[model samples]
Target: MVQTTPLVDRFGRVATDLRVSLTDRCNLRCSYCMPAEGLAWLPDERVLSDDEVVRLIGIGVSRLGIREVRFTGGEPLVRRGLSGIVARTRALDPGLELSLTTNGLGLVRLAGPLAEAGLDRVNVSLDSIRPETFHRITRRDRLHDVLEGLQAAADAGLGPIKVNAVLLRDVNDDQAAELLAWAVERGYELRFIEQMPLDAQHGWTRESMVTAEETLERLEKEFVLAPAAEPRGSAPAELFTVDGGPATVGVIASVTRPFCGDCDRVRLTADGQVRNCLFAREESDLRAALRSGVPDAEIARRWVSAMAGKRAGHGIDDPTFLQPDRPMSAIGG
Candidate 1:
C-alpha cells in the first residue's frame, strides 16, 4: 500500500514531518498556554497508546513519505513509557529523524533514557532565566529543575537542543538578552516565538504580541547577529547567529511571517485527530479508523486525504480568522 504519490496538499506542499502528541497532561501551567485551573483531562480510553502511535508513524513513513517525527504534548515527558515509544517508533524507520518537545520539568529524569531510546534531539519550553519571572510565567517554581534537566539532556548527547521561548509584551520580554546569554553559555540554541492566540483563556491580542522584528531588535543590542547564509529550508524559524559565537538563535513569526506555503508538518493529537495546520478549524478523526481495525493503508489514506484538504494557509491574518477551540496544550504544542 505504499503509494508512489507523496502526501501533497492541494497547494502542492508535500508533507515530510509528523508531530504526535503523547498526552494532554502537563505538570506546569504556563499562563500563556493554559488557564490556572479548570482543564479537563481526556479519558484513558480516548488517549492513544504507545503501540498505536508507533503504528501510525510507521504507516506515515512507509506509505506517506514522512521522514521526520516530533513528539509533542502538553509535555511529552509527562507520558509514561515515552522512552519506549521513542525506541519503538525509531525502530520502525532507522533513518527517520525523531525528536521531542517538552517543558523540561521531567527531562532531568528522562533525558538519558530518551537518548538511549533513540531520540535525536529536543526543544524545551523555557520562557525566562529569572526564577521569579519563570514562576510568574509558568506558575511553577521549577526554574532550577528545568536548568538541571537541560544539562541532563545535553549530557545525554542531545546536541543542538533548542529552547523555545514565547514572547509576551512586557512579560518576560525584557529578559531576551539574559536568556540568550544563558543559552549561549550552555551551548543551547534559543528561539523566540511570537505569542499566538492559543491560550485556553483566550487572553491573547494583537497588541500583546512581541513580533519577531521586535525580538531581533532587542537581541541585536546584546549580540552581533547576522542572518544565516543558507536557505531556511522548511523550518518554521528564521535563524541567526552571533558574529563569532557558538550559539545561534531563531525567531518564529507565525503571526507576522506565515510559513504556511511551505508547511510540511501535520499533527496527531493524543485523542487521534489529524490536524493539517496548528490553527486548523477542523480535524479528521484518525483514531476511529485505527480502532475500527482498518488496514494501515486505509489509515494512510485518511492522512493523505486530510493533507489534500489542507487550506492554502491557516488564515490567521484573515479578517474572519477564528481562534481554535483547542488550546495550545490540547493541540500538542
Candidate 2:
C-alpha cells in the first residue's frame, strides 16, 4: 500500500517510477554509449549489495510511491544472484511492476529462471539485425546469442518482450522495418528511440541520429500505426499500434521531442548516485550515506532533497549543446 506518503520531485511533481542500476559494468560496448577507450568500471566496493538494493527499493515503493521498478545495469543479468534479487522484490508487493533491461546476451540462460522469479517484463537492446552490422555497432560478436535470448525470453513468458533499437542514421536507420516486422509478427512491442545526447561517440552528430518522425514516416508506409491509448504520465515512449491488436509499436523521441515536463522518474546508479535528469550534470551520492548507518527514513529524506533539485528540463533544446560528460553506461540507459 502507498500509505500517506506521496512521491514528490523537485518541482513538487509526484513520481511513479524508479529506475535502478544493478551494475556499472557491461559486456558489449555499443559505440554510441561507450568509447573505444572504454570506461572506468566502478570499484567493486562501491556497488550495492543485494540487501542494499532491496532496501532502497522498499523505501522507494513504500515512501516514494514508486509503482514501477526497472532494473538496468552495465547489464543487470550479469550480476550474480539476480534471480534471488528479483524473487525478493517480487515478495515485496504484488502491485509492483518489476521490469529488467538487458543487452540480451545471456537471456537464453536466465530468462526462464528470472520469469519464475517474478520479473514482469523484459526489454532487450538491439540495434541492427545483420550480424555484421550488429557486431559493428555493439563491438560484440554475439548477434546469435541476442537472438536466442529474445526467443528464450518469449518462450519463458517474460514478455511481452520489447526491443529497444536506437536508430542512428548511418548505422541502422535502414533496418526499422526489419526490426518491427519480426516483433509485430511475434506479438512483441518494438520501440525505436532517437539517440539522445548522453554519449555521442565516434563523431556523433545530430545528422547521424534518426529522428522518431523519420522512423514513423518510414514504418507508416508499410504497416499502418494507430494510436494506442496510453495511461497518463509514462516514460519517453509514445504508444502506437499496427492497425490491429496483434502487435504494437512505440517511439521515444528524446532528442527530437523531449518529454521532460511529464518526466516523473529518477535513476539510481549502481554506485548509489541519484540522477534526477539523464541530461543533467547534477547527481547526488547516496551510497556513502546509506552505508554510514543512515536509516531508511533519513536516506529517503536526502533522496527527496536531491530529486527536488532536478532541472525543469534537459536543455538539448539549446542550438549548440554538447553531450553530457558521463557515459550512458554510468547513467544506466
Candidate 3:
C-alpha cells in the first residue's frame, strides 16, 4: 500500500525535495564548514542509524510530498554503509530526483557503487582547480583525487555531474569565469555560491564575499547569458549559460541577495532535528517522536504544522544577524 503524507510550511510550494544529512563529521577542516576547534561530533549512539534514516525517508516520501532526496554530509561518502542507504532510498520508487553532494575527496572509491545503487546525479564541491589554492582553501591536498572522482562519476554514467564553487573574495572569486567556462567545455552545470554567515572560525568577511550581481556583471562582459525559463524558488542561483550551450551556469546569491521568499526547504540533521532555515535558531525534533512509536499520521501532522508555523523566510538578512548556533556541517550545507 502506498502511504500518504501531508505537506507542511512549504507554503504554496510543494515540498518535493528532502536533503538528508548522514553525519555532521567531515574529514576536511575547510575554513567555511566548521570551527577551528572542530564540531563536537555526535556520539555514535546519538546518530540515526542507517535503518532509522531509511524509515524516516520512507515516511517523508510516502506522506510529505517529497519526490526528491539528496544525501549530504560533512562528507556523505565518509559514511560506511552509504551505498546500502542509497539502495534503500532508491527502493522506495519515490519517482524523485536522487542526488548526492560531496567534497569529492572520497568520491573515487564510492562513486561506482553509489551510481549502480541508483544515485541519479552527483555534485562535487570544488572551489579551485589550483593545487596550492585548493590546499589553502580546504586545508587538504586531494585535488588529483577529486578530479579523478569527478571523472569516475562520469564514467559510472552518473551524467550531468555538477561542480559547486563558493566565491570567496581574494580566494576563488577570480576563478568564477574560468570555472564556469571549464564546466561548459565538459558539459557540467557549474554553480557559484556566495558565502554566507558560516562559523566564525572560517573568518568570513562580508568584504571577502562576492555577490551574484558582481558575478553576473563579470561574466556577461564576455558570455551572453539570458535568464532561465523558470527561476527555481528561493534558490540563490542566477542560472545562465554560454549562449547556445546545453550546460548552464548558476549563481546563488544567498548572502548578498537573500531568497527568503519562496524558500521551500526544511533540513534534517544527521541527529534528526528539523531546521526551518540555515540561519534558524530553532528546530523541531522528529526522531524522538518516531522512537516513541507515534504513528506516521501524527508525524505528518507535526510536519505540516511545523512547516506552516515556520517563518515565511529565514531572517538571515536581518541587519543584526545572529549566527545559527549550529555550524554549516551540522546544518547539512
Write candidate 1's Cα lDDT for 204-303 as tens digits: 8888799999999998897999888768989999989776545678999999998888898989999999998999989999999999999987888888
Per-residue alpha-carbon lDDT of candidate 2 for residues 124-201, written as tens digits (9 for 90 to 100)? 999888999998888889999999999999999888888999987777888898888888777778989888766635
Which residue pairs overlap in candidate 3's backbone? 4-63, 5-63, 9-307, 9-308, 236-252, 237-251
lDDT of 1: 0.89
Error of 2 at 323 (Å): 3.1
Clashing pairs counted in every model: 0, 2, 6
Local error of candidate 2 at residue 246 (angstroms): 3.6
Cα lDDT of model 3 by residue, 17-77, tens digit: 6789998888777777665556788898878889889988888888787787888887888
- Model 2, backbone clash pairs (residues 3+ apart or across chains), number: 2
Poorest stretch of ten by lDDT in candidate 1: 239-248
Candidate 1: give its CA RMSD in angstroms: 1.2
Instruction: TM-score for candidate 1, please give it.
Output: 0.98
Residue 290, model 3: lDDT of: 80
Between prediction 1 and prediction 3, the one with superior lDDT is 1
Model 2 lowest lDDT segment of ten = 1-10
lDDT of 2: 0.84
The best-first sequence of candidates by TM-score reads 1, 2, 3
Per-residue lDDT value at 295 in model 3: 81
